[model samples]
Structures are given as structure tokens and as C-alpha cells.
Target: MNTSEYGKVAAHTLKLRVEGMDCGACALKIESALKRLPGVSDINVNFGTEMLALNHDAGRTSRQVIEDKIRNLGYTPRPAAAEIAIPIDTGRQEDRPWWQTRKSRLVLITAALLAVAFGVAWVAPSLSFYAYVAAALVGLVPIARRALAGAMSGTPFSIETLMSVAAAGAITIGAAEEAAVVIFLFAVGELLENVAAGRARAGIKALIGLVPRVAQIEQDGEIRQVPVEQLRVGDVAVVRPGDRVPSDGEIIEGLSELDEAPVTGESVPLSKTVGALVYAGSINGNGTLRISITKTAADNTIARIIHLVENAQASKAPTARFIDNFAAYYTPASMAAAVLIIVVPPLIFGADWETWIYRGLATLLIACPCALVISTPAAIASGLAAGARRVLLVKGGAALETLGKITAVAFDKTGTLTVGKPEVTDVAAIEGDEDDMLAKAAAVEQGSSHPLGLAIIAAARSRGLAIPQTFGGASAVPGKAVVARLRDGFVSVGSPRHASELNLLPDTLSDQVQKLEGEGKTVVIVATKDLALGLLALRDEPRPDAAAGIRDLKALGLQTIMLTGDNRRTGQAIANVLGLDVRAELLPDAKLDAIAQLKAHGPVAMVGDGINDAPALAASSVGIAMGGGTDVALETADAALLSNRVGGVAELVVLARATLSNIRQNIVIALGLKAIFLMTTLLGISSLWMAILADTGATVLVTANALRLLRVRPTTAASPGESA
Candidate 1:
């Protein structure tokens, strides 16, 4: 029975590494070849990462067929291998670096061909044609053969086909030297491009290689070497000093300083002890550790980070998408223009067909748009990869672009600009004993998730007040208060707003609420059925980095605003510390309106972390979530800081601007060279060989320029004028 008869072709998607793609045109060729297969549905080829993501019917066409099709298109496809990264200062060695791979061999062979062709032409002019042909055959044979194979398999419009046709045309016109130079130079450019592309793709691979493949696991009181994949949750692992943690887990014993640079970009090694969480790949220092694994190898923090960074590289910016769309039509139009140049000029004006036809072939060689197509993605990929290493995850090219333009950044006060942790600042009990009332309020706040509620519980516990184990439902909304059922009556503990909504607080008690609130503290009321027992005041302090970060943004001339649901005094206090424009007493929907209003002034970014911030985050020009561990924040924001560093925002802004500047430089170099060469070729002043070199040289130059972004690191000088 046929495979399809036995089983319906199961709809499936496959992600694989595609090797030997030279340019954006090569990516297009791979995509065009694979999509023609019987079962293939979608083909996405990313030249920046050299990855092909495809969706196809499994039974109708096997994976082998897809691989073979790609091979016929002059590329190689393989299943993605497991991730690996070599740790710094470790005794173990890593796999051979990218420069030592096939790319090096290609560069060497092409350089030899270039030397032979130029040497023979200068030394013996008579045999120069044959020598050039020999070099062309040697250098162009692989590309020419691939084009022939593609032609035999009914593939069309590939860069290989275009180059092969142009070379054959030149040889026919006694221009074999030009043809040989074109082939040799093209090879050189592509190899250099391969190095650049490989550098960008290596970021995640380098991250993966940081962790040890085999870890020391404690099983039944014995330490045994085991692969990390085999280690399950709850497995205790023994991590010695000068070793890396095997997975995300809590330390059950021992103490150490953990270097978390690989995971969160933290430069300082953090002190860790029992019950402290240690992430996979963090280097242990000075002391051994017995860690209880909380996540498997696949679900560890390192894996999650790698996955997000890879996804960020895959997503295209608006400019990249537009370039792709433009190139799709550009190639076909060039073919048409080539035909018109050859036939129209000779037939209508009685021009020499040989010279005009040669010009037409040269035009086709110039028209592939390889350099133009890659202009944005190359820069964007480099920027994204570098940002990932610095703890900033710009989700896509669009976000990176938007981030560069943000003139005003609206900050959510509670968890973004300030530390989310709150503490009890003051307490006033009007009717009952302050200690008894605080204890009852703390009991009602038991197991509560709110920062203010946790503060009350913590304050009571620290003062030796006994808290009951259980509590009833909240008296008002979820964030407002906590209510506990009692023998006499229910006791409710919530914000002053809850009391005002219920009309339970007396006017005299209201005065006390205002007085406490005036001191920049959040006031809460603890009440029985009729009378108020007391008022509790809590305050969340701004992060130490908050003032510095805001100062830096302001120094850069960015308009800053603090948006919060906290009352005027509380919000103003935090804003004043950061020296920001303040917007207070705004609920979730009101926050969305505030974001819209800010957008009207200029491009605006919203910095937030919470469920309520989601709507405003979506409404802003760019939504930057703090420490994207929260599901809602991760889903809503376009960018995330992996660590709880408010200063990451400033780093992201600088990086984004640098990326935009790099992108502009690449575009100028790519299009400017193309324009100059196009004019020269059309005017018959530049030979076909020169045109090809110009295209190749421009690609190399732009790529090298874009790589400059990789050097603009976080916590360093990213720009010339860093603001006074």
C-alpha cells in the first residue's frame, strides 16, 4: 500500500538549518524550489539565520524528499541539532568555531581562482582567454552545475540561473576574462557574507554551549555522571565550586556565589544559599551545592531564553517586509528590461546587436537585488542577537524600529520604575488596640497575592502577632481588600477606596486617611459591620536604578511620564524622585487613554509589568515589559528585559537608536553603489565584470558596517553624544 493510502498526509511543520545559501536571492531560490514539491504548503527561508521553516503534508512527501529538493536547489538542509555553548574558563573544549568550517575552505579556493585568472591575464595575454575560461570552469562549475540541475528539475528565476546565463553570454562574446572575474569575485563576497551570517546565528548557539551536557546527579546517596536530558524534575544535582548549574532549580544545601551572566547578563556573581533559586548555566563559585531541579532540560530558563531570542531573529521588521515585497517584483522586471534592452534598441534604432546584447546580459547580472534585499535583515539580526546577550529581548524588527523613535516614555509606577515590594510605613487604630487590629488584618491577608496585603502580613508576623491560617472572600474587588469570617462578625481589611465605596468610614476617620495619604503612603481600612478599627499605611520604594535610569533618559532629551492608579500624593512622590511628568489616579482603561494621548505628542513607549498594563502596552508605540516572566506582560509587550533591571530600558533605547543608524548606513551603501553602477553599466562605461564586483563589494561593505552594531554593547558607550 502507498503511504498516503495507509495514512492521510498528516499536516506538520518542520524547522531545519539550511546551509550554503549565499544571499537573499539564494533564500528565494530555496523557497521557490521547495514550494513546488507535491506536499509542501508554506516555505519561509531566513537568510539572516540560515534557517528554513516549512509546513507540509508528511505522508504525501517525505522529509527526505524535502532535503533532496533543497540539495537540487544548491543548498543543504538538515534537522536542527541540540543546542550547545562552551563555558568560559572551563577545562572542556568546544567544537570548531564557524571560521574553521566549510566557509574557510570556500574562501581559500575562490582566492586561488582569482589569483590564477589575474596572473595568467597579465603574464600571457595570448592564452588569457583560455586561462580565464579554465578558472571560470573551476570557479563557476559548482554554481553552473547547480543551475543546470535546477533547470533539469524545472526550477527557474534563481540567482544561479541568472549568473550562469550571463557568464555563458560573456564567453560567447570573447569576454571570458570578465566572466571568470565575475565568478571569482562573487565567490569571495558570498564567503565573507557567510562569515557575517554565521556570526549573527552563533549567538544562541554560544548561549546553549555554556551549559555542561553531563551533570553530577545524586541518586540514592551516590553521585553519578548523567546527561542533563535524562535528569527529571526533583532530581538532586551536586554542583561543585567552579562548575555550572545543570538546570533551573532551588538550592537544597550548601552556599555559593553564582555568576548569572549567561542567563540574565548579570556581571556580578550573586550570593546563594539553601532555598535560593539557581538557573541553568550559572557558574558556581567557591562552594558546592546540592540543588533540587525544578525544570527539565527542555524547560529550563536557558532554553526559554534561547527560544525567545531565536524567535526575535525570525520576526521581520516592517522595512524588511517591504524590501522583500519590492524584490519579489524587482527580479521579474529586470528580466523584462533585459529583454527590452537587447531587442528594442537594435530593432528600432539599428544599433549593433552584439554590443547591445552584451549590455543586456550585463544588466541581468546587475539586477539580482541581492544586496538590496538583505540590507535591513542583516542589521536587524545583528541588533537582536546583541540585545539578547545584554538582557534586552526586542521581540521583532518592528519593535526595534519603534524603540529607536520613542521620544516620550510613559512608566508604570508600581512595578516598572519602582520596586514592586511594599512595606507597612504607618498604622492608626481609632477604635481598637492597634496591635490586635493589625494582627486581625494580617490574618485576613494570609495567602493574599497583592503587594500591600503581603506587606501587612509581613509587618504583623515580624511584630510577633499570630496570624490565623484561613480567610474568607475579599470584601470588595480582588485588589481592594481581604475579608475573614468570624464568630461575632466578618472583619474586612482593604484600601480606603473600599471603605468610601461602602460608606462605612466616619468623616473623622476620613481626616486621618487624608493625613496619612499626604505623607505618600497607601492607606487601608480595617473595619467591622459598622465601626472602623484602624488605618494602615504602606509604601513601595523606587528601585535604586530608577532614578539613575530616568536621569539618563531625561539627559538624552526624552520626555518622561509616570502613569499609575495610586492617588496624587503617592504617585507624585515617586515621580518627583525620578524627576518625571506624573499622571495619577488612572485605572487600566484610563491608562490606555493616557498612552494614546502620549502617542499624539510623539512616538511613545510604555514601560509596565502587570495584567492591567496589557491594554496600555498594546496601545503605545512600543511596549517594554519589565522582566518578562509574567505571562500577560510577555504576551502584550514588544520588548522585555530578562532581569528586573529598570536600567535595561535605557540600554534598549540606545541599542535601538544604534540599530536604526546602522540600518540607514547599510541602505545608503547598498542603494548608492547600485545606483552608481546601474548608471555606469547602462551608459556602457563599466564592463559587466565591474558591475558584478560593485554588487559584491557593496554587499561586503554594508555587512561589515552593520556588524558595527554588535560592538555597541549595553553598559558601554553606545553613542558619541551620550547627553550632558
Candidate 2:
């Protein structure tokens, strides 16, 4: 029967905060157990974050039942929507060293007992056997109980089972001292592993501390403190010099420099002016400002970032999935191999039963496969956490892996490659009175949501042109045109192609349009009924970092192309500035086709920021979204660059490659060490103590290797620990 079978109804997914997941195999075991339950469709367990993202039919399964199921498997589980409870013994332990942790203290007591037993064995030969027996009983009791618990839970092939069997086998052979030492070291290793996982998780949570609980908002003329969660949109916050901004808002008064390092990873401060955006965690410098909140505290950028990062941690990577699948089979194979070692050697070669059986016990302990199972997930979690700190967010490990290998990149012109804000440069009156044309056009665009329409209305207002107080709502379609009813006739403002199709274009204006388009200006034709009134040419400046960003990407060997709906001349003019290939006059579907065509060459990345481009982003091998853009783009893309600096593409690629390399290194180190230890144990060259120590050592080594990713920094960004 297929284990992947799901409920008939679509499953709702949620991330659950899980505890007592000791290893990658523990994650695999939990996944297997949950899948056997009714209504569960999928389960993604991230050992690094100790989280499980699962999907189940709500009617069949509930959160409380899911929690109960996890508890049944000898683990802890709760909805991730609530804060994870720390299992640390708080208060007294909080003031003491980490070594004083309850688990660590227990391990220390076990070690001290083992030490006294060994000392007595050397000093008093008569009491040596009794001391060793006491030590073995004390140490083996807890291990045996855990093994029994695992057996009762239907997980008989667990690490605890292997440890319990090995210790019992050693003691039965009169190796009581060796058995006691193995337990001491094994318990110590368990404590170290839990601590290591905690440290790995902390890297992702480091940003949580930056969010302020209270904000100072001025409700009349007097400033008062209010909880951030209580702050409402349109509420004004009065930020003094050297304070963190408490909400996603727009500066309505004053000016200052903002250190955006908390969000954008830019070390240098950015100047804040009236109308500029201020995020919840950004630090203000050297000025007082009044900011009108645009988003409440819960919906702010910082909060969204934290949410996405946690989602990323819960998301599994291809390598992790493969490793988990491999471990599932590897564990059983190892048990079979150990069984063969115990019986086959004594029967076939007439070897002594005691020696071969002892060898088999050591082999079982060495073949646990915990290190190999965790190799990829640990590195992937660290990668996701590090990317968040650098202000880049990858949707999952799969995207991170794909991002590193992107060979070709397609960019949307208006927003991605250039500042999407276009200023009105020329309004050529081809027919009718200029004032009437401007007035009618602005009045028609008064209720528009398009950038070009907004620009037209703003230009008209700046020139003191009369904008009608009441206007009909404008209707629009992507890549086509927008139209609204005017008092005189219908006013149309959109693509020149739309104007020509409507028979409102004049042949004489061809040369004028050609000249403006050649200068890289976006020309929008304004028409009414049967005649063209005027054409507005707007110039959207390329972003300051666009050229350098293009250069960086090119130098890194990614082919860059400008994919836009703009006509050929305008597209070419802009592409020429960035020295990129150009694809122009494309509709939304055409952009999707372009992505497919690009993917034929190799893995392609589509960078876009509009609803029209969502299909293209979803179709590409990897999609990169500008954080400031449409929600659809953000949702569709694989990764998000949260700042306008397109140079971040370089940073993202570098970080992805580094993370992949780190994962590879961890896998090699994990498997290579395991193989050598397993072989030694099978050949009777390794003892039970050596096998347990080697297995524990490999776990610590791989964990330490994966932790190196948290130190990964962008090449051109900032030095380690520097605010970038």
C-alpha cells in the first residue's frame, strides 16, 4: 500500500512546534508514525528547528488530536502559532552555567558514579565486582526504560533499543565497567546534541528580540506609550532621535537617517524624508519624526519576514528528503547486517559465539545512522536562517538549491530593472486644447490604481489643472488599456497599441512617438471617442544599482535579459544601459512563454513585481520577487529580495552556493566517518565504547559543520558581525 495516500478533501497545513526530536531519524520516525494516522496527507519534519509542518483533513483530525498523536510517539507538539515553551529549568539554571542544565547535571552524576566504580575496581579488588555491578545497574536502568518505552510505542528499532541491547550484552559478558562508561558518554552526548540544536534554532530567532513591545504614539499633542499589538493603521507614532520605528508606516513630518540594517542588511544609514517608508524594527538617527502607520504591528514587514522564515525552516529540502528516505532503509539494513554478523560468523567460520556476538553488538551501535540522516537538514535550516538575517528569504531548501544553479535570469523592466516610478516628461498635444486634454485625462484617471494613471493625475495636479471632484471609476486589464467615462466622452489612457486598435491614432504623430520611444520613454496615448487628444511620455529612471547589479550577475556567469511589455525601441534603450538581451512587446502569456523558452537553455530565474508576471514566476525554474511589489508576485516567487538593491541577486546566489557546499561537506563527513566506524566494529577491531563514542562524535561534528553556515556573509555586503 502507498504510504503517501491522503484524505479525499484538501488538507490544511500548519507548522507545529515539536520537542524531543533527538535526530534526523527521529524526524523520519515521527513522519512515518503520523502518516499512518487517518487524514494526514503530508508531514515535513525539520530537526534543526524541531518543527513539523503537516497537512491533514480538519474534519478527521484536530490540533489537539495531532498533539496527542505526537505525544504518543514520545515527543512534544503544539501549534506553532503559540510561542514555544522553553524546557530549560529556569530561574536557578538561568543564572548558572549551561553545564548546570538538568540534563547536563544528570549526565554529570552518572559520570561521577562511573568514575567511582572505576576507582574502586583499581584500589579494592575484593569490592571491584560489586562496584561495577552497581554502576552498570544505575546507568542501564534509564536506558532500558527508554528502550521499553520505544518498544511500547512500536518503534523497536530505535537508538535507545540499540544502546539498551549493547549495554546489556556488555554487562552479561562481565564487561560491566565498559558498559557503564558507554552510558555516561552517551548521556553526555545527548545533552550536547540538544544544546547544539538549541543553538542552531537561535540563529533563526535572533531577530525576534529586535521587535519592541511598546510604541510611543501621539494621540492629540501629547505622546503616550501603547502596546505595539494595539497600534492601529493611521495612528501616528512620534519617534524621537535614536529610537526604533514601531510599525510599518509613512513619515508624515520631520526627517532623519534610518539604520535599516535590521531589515535590509545595509550597514550605512538611509536618509528618511517625508513620505518615505519606515519599518517596525528600523532604528532612527538624529531627528524626531511623526509617522502615520500604514500596517498594524501584526501585519508589519518584520512580522511577515519572521513568519516566512519560520515557514522556510519547516519546509524540507530535496537532499533532506532523500537522506531521510535512505535512512529509513539503512536502519533496517544495518539491523539485518548485525544479525548476520552475530550468527553467520559463528556458524559458517566456526568462530567463538561470545566474540562474534560482542562484535555484532558494537556494530549495531555504530550503524545507528543518526549523523547521516541529519546531514542535510541541519545545513539547510542554517542556510534559511542566515539568508533571513541578510534580508533575503528563500521559500525552502529546494529554492535555495535551485537559486544557486540559475544560469539565465529574466527581469521585468518597469519595476525590477528600473525604478517603477515614472515621472511625466512630455505631454504632447497632438489635437484639442492642452488644458482641456490634461484636465479630462486627470479627471478620468482620478480613481485609477495603476502607476501610470497615478502619475498622470499627479502631473495634472502639479500644473494647477482642475481635476473633477467626482469622477467615474476607471476599468483596466493587464497589458491592454484602461478607460473611464468623462462628461464629454469616454477618456482612454493606456498602451499606444490600444490607441491604434481603437482607430484613435494619427499617422502624423508616428515620428514624434518614435523619437520619444527611442529616448527610452514610455508613451501613453490619451484619446476620447473618435480622436487622439495627446500623448504623454514618461521616463522611469533605471535604479541606481541596476547597472552594477547587472555587471555582478554577468560576471558571475548568469545571462541577463530584459523582458517587458514596452515596445522594441524603448526596451532596447533600457537594455543597452544594462548591457542585457532584450525581449519586448510581450503580453502576460508571452512572458510565461519566455520563461519556458529560457528554461530550455538551463535553469532560469524570473524576477518580477506585478500580477501580470505571476504565471511567469511560477513557470520559471526559480522566481525572485522584489519585496516592495505586488502580493501575488511575492506569493508566486521562490525567493524574495527584501530591498531595492538588485545587487542582492549576487548576494543570494553566493549564499546559496555556500550553503549547498556546506551541506555536501556535512554529508560526506557524516557518512565517511560512519562507514569507517561500522567496518571497524564488524571486524571486531572496535569495542562498544569506541562505537558509541564515534557515533556521538560524528553527530557533534556534523552539527558543528552545519553551524558554520550561520557565519556565512555576502561577498560584497559587510564583514562578519558588521551590520549589513
| Candidate 2 runs further than 4 Å off | 1-16, 20-22, 33-45, 52-97, 100-102, 218-222, 273-275, 423-538, 629-634, 716-724
- Candidate 2 TM-score, C-alpha based: 0.79
Candidate 2: worst-modelled 10 consecutive residues by lDDT:
84-93
Model 1 has an lDDT value of 0.78
Residue pairs with clashing backbones, model 1: 84-208, 84-209, 85-208, 85-209, 85-210, 86-209
Kindly list the per-residue Cα lDDT of model 2 for residues 1-724, writing each as its tens digit: 1223563546677677676575776776677667776888767777666678877877788767778777766566755543311212224322245586655766987888888998998999888867877887887776677667556655677777888888888888777777887888888877777777777877555776666778899877889999788899899998889889887899999989999888876788989899998887899999999999998876777777776776787677888878877876887798899899999988999999899888888888887777887788788878888888878888988999888788988899988888879878888887877777777778777878777778888899899987754345777756877777866667877788888888877887666887888888878888877888888888887888888888878877889998999888889988988889999999988888888888998999888774456778889998888855224434668888877578878778877877888888987888788788888877778888888976787888888888788887775533222211
lDDT of 1 by residue, 1-724 (tens): 1135557655677877777664666776677677667877767777765667777777688788888888876676666644432212222112345455555665667668768877987998888889878877777778788888666655455566778888888888888888877887777777787776666666767777877889999888899999888889999999999999998899999989999987777788999999998888899999999999998887787777776766776778898888888887887888888889889989999999888888888878777677887788878888888887776888888999999889999999877887788888787888878898898888777767777888998999899987655435445557666788654578889778888888978898899888877768788899886768988888897887888888778766789899999888889888877788999999888898988888898899999884558778889999988863434434558888767677788788888888888888888887788778778887899898787866678888877777777777656223423221
Error of 2 at 596 (Å): 1.4
C-alpha RMSD (angstroms) for model 1: 6.2
